[model samples]
Target chain A: MVERTVRIGSTHGLHARPAKLFTQAAAASGAAVTIQKAGGAPVNAASILAVIAQGIDHGDDVTIVVDGGDESAVLDQLVELLSTDHDE
Target chain B: MMEIKGTGIGQGVAVGPVVRMAEALPEPVDRPSHLDPEREGERARASLSVVAAELANRGAKAGGAAKDVLEAQAMMAEDPSLIDEVTKLLATGKTAERAVYESFAAYRDLLAGMGGYMGERAADLDDISQRVIAHLLKLPAPGVPNPGHPFVLVARDLAPADTATLDLDQVLGLVTVDGGPTSHTAILAREKSIVAIVGATDAASLADGDTVVVACR
Candidate 1:
């Protein structure tokens, strides 16, 4: 599995809209992905419910894991999604 | 049959049946658990995990904006910090029901006490807590009703979770007895272009299936 840590950039954190956008991207990547808040248990990245439940706020560090299906490219794409402020 | 006046959200108008959102359940009594602390803790964990999984499943089916809200709610159901709180209460010999109730209440109070954005989160916490408690007791989760027909939702107020999952195509309008124009309910109505009347104190008397007209002058 390939992994990367990135800070949440949305001012409101990973609330409804941002979480939806991120989870949709992860699911569409056609790769297995998991995300965990810093020092938190990992949850399925494609599951919007699981991602929002983490209550990840802005400035929080989260680790993203991507396994299979062009891991590096998918990881970079997810990392960019995490770092962008979708709330704005 | 009577016209009630209040602040209307957005310019749209609608007419339909009224469906009331269920009220929050009363707090669980601080009673000792008949079961062993270990057993009660296990029960609490099982309920929490079940509710979490259920929320995730609902989110998966919902998609769009509703998908995100449901997903977040699922996370809240099994939140590590929240689970920690439940475990601590159960260790003290509290019943699983009370443990879940108190744990969620603690976080709800904390967030409500913070005000602003955090204050808004308190409602979400309340919704999750209710769902977990309902699961433990085998009761229907308290939320917007699906009467199988288009209706106007009347409630004391709408929580973020309730509003997020509302079926817009079926909801002709919204009316709340409490909450201001800036409340989450109003904002959602405005965003979705749904007709809404908020802070209608007299709306408290509105009953289920009561026909009402929502209009703005």
Candidate 2:
């Protein structure tokens, strides 16, 4: 498994639209991915409900773990997603 | 000649027959399943898949912002995390309908607990739960009604998924009993330029087929 920690960038945090974009990308990657707040239990990253329920606010640090299916590439893409402000 | 007051969205005065949207389905009973775990799991999966596909199709047809809202709802229907919960419940011999209900309710409560915009999202989960449960039970899914003509819609509140697919021409106006001006129903009404009055809790007493005048300032 490969993991990267990044701060959420959306101005309003991981709400529906941003959460949907992130979860859709994660599900499309065909990789086992999980996301969690720093020191929080990881949840399936492909679940929009789980992601939104985390209440990940802007600048909140989160760790995403990816296993199999081009781990490095998927991690890079998702990391970029987290670092960019989607609400802009 | 009842005077129902609420915050209006967009603007217009429309007069038409009232078409009441169905109430949300009752919570499923948590009874043990007579079918095997595998069979119950299959039933749950089938309903979820069907609901997901239907949402996706409606999203495609909807286009614009409605498309995004519907697409997100579709994702919720087949969310792998939710499926895992359903599967676990089935393993415990729960009926497919009850399993789906409890699983979605868990997330619903979590999101609602966040309050504000997140709390609004709880309605989306509720809509999906109703669709899946309706499918499992072979019942009509409660949502925007198609009464075969233009009408003023009345409901507790409109879910985004319902608003996304609303036939504007067919729905002359909207009166919701349980939504504030910032609710998804109001937002969509503004986006689509539909006349709407939200948070008119008194509107609940309005009966179907009652001709009412809806005027938005």
Candidate 3:
């Protein structure tokens, strides 16, 4: 399993549209990916409910876990995705 | 005999007794010491499956995107992973209620945070804020007097999501629990030419099925 930490950059943190977008991106990876807050149990990264349920806020640190052969590529893209906020 | 006011997010007027719509929290299940964790998990899975099936049937009757979302939720509520998690917690001597409480804490916090975040970006932020707050309001303890088919909805607040879900053709006016200038509900109501009132603290106390009028500035 490979893990990475990223900060939320969305103006609204990770709610509604942004959450939907992020989950879609994660789902596209085709990897068994899970996200969690520090000390939180991993949840399905592709489920909007699970993602929003993480209670991530702007500037909160989140750990992403990917376990599979393509873990490295998935981690790279997700980290890149989390780095920038969506446009208004 | 009196009128209460709130901002209206959707256009049009509806008159009826206020009927609060809120989901009930699930009750805790008792487990016997003789039951193995795996067996207990199967039981939880079965119960969740029944809930999901019931919700799916309800969604089909509802017929809309909202209905689709409910269907999706039913699936989540039945997820094997969710079942396993709940079972694991129960196996550790945690009561079902306690487990659900702990698990939902994160979900609740997330929703609250999301509500706050959405509020800041909202073009009509105030109305959305009001609606978000309404999520916390308790339905009248003794079945919030059914506003026997409310002709107009008087609320402390109404959010965009709530407005989106409401059928505007049925509402006569909207009164809010909280809101001020720049409330999205007011703006939207104005666009729809729906009568509305805002910033009324006692709006929720109006008698069920009372006929009232509103003047929107």
Candidate 3's displacement at residue A25, Å, is: 3.2
Give me the displacement of residue B35 in model 3, in angstroms: 9.3
Full candidate order by DockQ, most accurate first: 2, 3, 1
Off by over 4 Å in 2: none
| Residue A82, candidate 1: C-alpha displacement in angstroms | 7.1
Candidate 1 chain B has its poorest 10 consecutive residues by lDDT at B61-70
Off by over 4 Å in 3: A1-9, A27-30, A34-65, B5-85, B92-102, B109-115, B118-150, B154-162, B176-199
Better of 1 and 3 by lDDT: 1
**Per-residue lDDT of A59 in model 1:** 99
iRMSD for every model:
6.0, 0.8, 4.4
The DockQ for candidate 1, computed on C-alphas, is: 0.16
Q: What is the Å distance of residue A18 in model 1 from its true position?
A: 6.7
At residue B21, give the lDDT of candidate 2: 94
lDDT by candidate, in order shown: 0.82, 0.91, 0.56
Highest lDDT scorer: 2
lDDT assessment of candidate 1: 0.82
In model 2, pairs of residues that clash are: none
Where does candidate 3 chain B have its weakest 10-residue lDDT segment? B136-145
- Residue B136 lDDT in candidate 1: 87
Ranking by TM-score: 2, 1, 3
